[model samples]
Target: MTNKPAQATLLPDNIAALTAYSSAKSEKISGNTWLNANESPYTKEACIEIRALNRYPDPQPQVVIDAYSTYASVDSDQVIMTRGADEGIELLVRTYCEPAKDRISLFLPTYGMYKVTADTHNVQINSLSQDLLLNGEVKDIINAVSGSKLVFICNPNNPTGAVTSVEKIAELTKSLANKAIVVVDEAYIEFSESYSCALLIKDFDNLVVLRTLSKAFALAGLRTGFMLGAKNTLAPVRKVIAPYPVSTVVAQIAANALCSDAITQMRRQVVILNKAKATLIDWLEQSPAVSKILSGEGNFVTLQLKDKALLTLATNTGLIMRPFKLYNQDNWLRISIGNEQELKSVKDWLNAISAQV
Candidate 1:
């Protein structure tokens, strides 16, 4: 209340560096299979009730919470729903990260939103520079958060798509206690051969792991995402959250999917996509334009090029994939595993380009 200037918003001015997230609206993507978002190509097969959309979705839908909690094997009190996993990240930042004061950090080349959300809250992000596995960066992470409070790890991380081996993640969680909040984003754990950090939430109150239906449920338009954390950890975080973060249609469809025959169908699709991913890696490895493929435990794969110039050359044709320049991964491009036909489209186009090169 002294003589300080009036603040413009709750966030810091450096928050301006964060850009609005734009999904691909290009024509090339529409014509091909849609796989870039890690979404289930399958739509909600549930018979939509006309009344479902007419009424307001449960503000805290008990059924949806219970289902997600049970599916994740966590307590109902430990779950919180949001518009999407994207929204869940935002909620966590808003509730905990103090812009210009407290900071949030993550592994370089992991999820972009952790940094973006922190920036919006004016929370600085310190990232440790490490290659594929996060083995050597323990010291880097410790240094980044000299005065920070949160550290986020995108398991089966996006862009790079590698799951930090559980041994490494657990070590980081134990070591970071009292120093920072450890957020393990298991958005792609379904595709992994490993168990989810969800089962471990009770043991570490400092851990907050994220999961989404947008990928496996094939419900992108429905926009549903959730976070798992200890009840004590969520209490202060809950105070700053919105009242109606999730919609009715999303809850109904997602809840229905939890118990539906969707799991079996989903697993079948995974088997197909994993095979395609391996095929693409093999093909890309043979191409001179591609340098190497990064390991991801998620549904997608990221190919690192000798130079980003090759990626730029590919995108000008309207073939959209994620870019990693901001993360110092200028030579990397992330591609989601779509259906067989879509895979053919991407492969054929790249092969054609290979012939010309």
Candidate 2:
């Protein structure tokens, strides 16, 4: 390797933000049933034949759409299948958000990738202040980020796992009409009180609801996600996407996963996950060290602990929980709602820590 230093002027001005995204790390600790990334441990319905692999998959998988149509009850034309909702997020930015001419707005300590994607194109970002979540800073976001071309909301938001009302969303959509494209990310809505915002696509052309098979349907490994919007919103996205956006294998398995029986299975499992989540929430609430538990409607729960050092205690015990750094809430940690055993381990860790004090 050459030791010569590169010229300073050659360094791109915005490249630092472009390079900040880091992939979540994984550890293969034995008997450590994984739940760090909000993935279900069960297998999805599958019958993707190898023969189908000979042909390129549909750019927007019809089978996936039909399945999603029946599952989500939106028209097939309104859906655009993706690699995961993450891709849907990227597609929206590439389609509508021009680097210098446009801007993107987001409320945070939510999903990081939304900001990351915008930063990739040198898009201007309008982020909420630290107290934005508690206060009605959503009102401020709309007023302050005037002329923002795109707005993103992660319902039952990531990390916090709190939800905003559909009525409130509808009001925001109506206000931002033609002014901004509002994206409602429902990746975790399967476990929420709110239904998928896909239904709003019929009423508002400005709305784009991002959903994923990864969280609720246990299809994260398949890398399949979808976007629901009027055809107009997707037209520009189509222009920028690859011809074979989804693989044949993904389409077939996704189709199989969408069958009636599979839908029933997911609904049944939702009941199970809800119970597990409640159990963990009650256990967490009993601890004085745990001061706050955000209304955990998603497949995860975030807690605010008295001792910031307990974050290390949870991790060193072979649990890979995500400690939030976005807002510098050093005392907070997020734990995915795992199956019976996994939740028990979290409870046990908390119990041990409480005893030490």
Best by TM-score, which number? 2
User: Candidate 1 residues 1-357, lDDT tens each?
Assistant: 666556545545575456855554422343234545666555556676666577666787889889888878899999988777888788888888776788776667666677767767777777665462366676655665566687778877776776677767676777778777788777777787474777778788888988887776677777778888999988876777677766776677777878746667777777777787888778788877776777557778777766666654455554556655644557667788777767776786577667656
**lDDT of each model, Cα atoms only?**
0.72, 0.78
Best by lDDT: 2
Cα TM-score of candidate 2: 0.91
The TM-score measured for candidate 1 stands at 0.86
Q: For model 2, how does the per-residue alpha-carbon lDDT over 1-357 read when each residue is reduced to its tens digit?
A: 755457545665676437565544443443354557787856754654787667776787776788897777688888888888988989899889887778988877778888888887778888864245335655765696578888888887887776777876777788888899989999998887355676778899999999998888888888888888888887788888878888888888888878898878988888898888888888988876787888557888888888878766666767677666635667777778787877777887888888765
Tell me the lDDT of model 1 at 176: 78
Summed over model 1, clashes come to 3
Candidate 2 residue runs with Cα over 4 Å from true position: 1-11, 26-31, 129-141, 193-195
Backbone clashes, each candidate: 3, 2
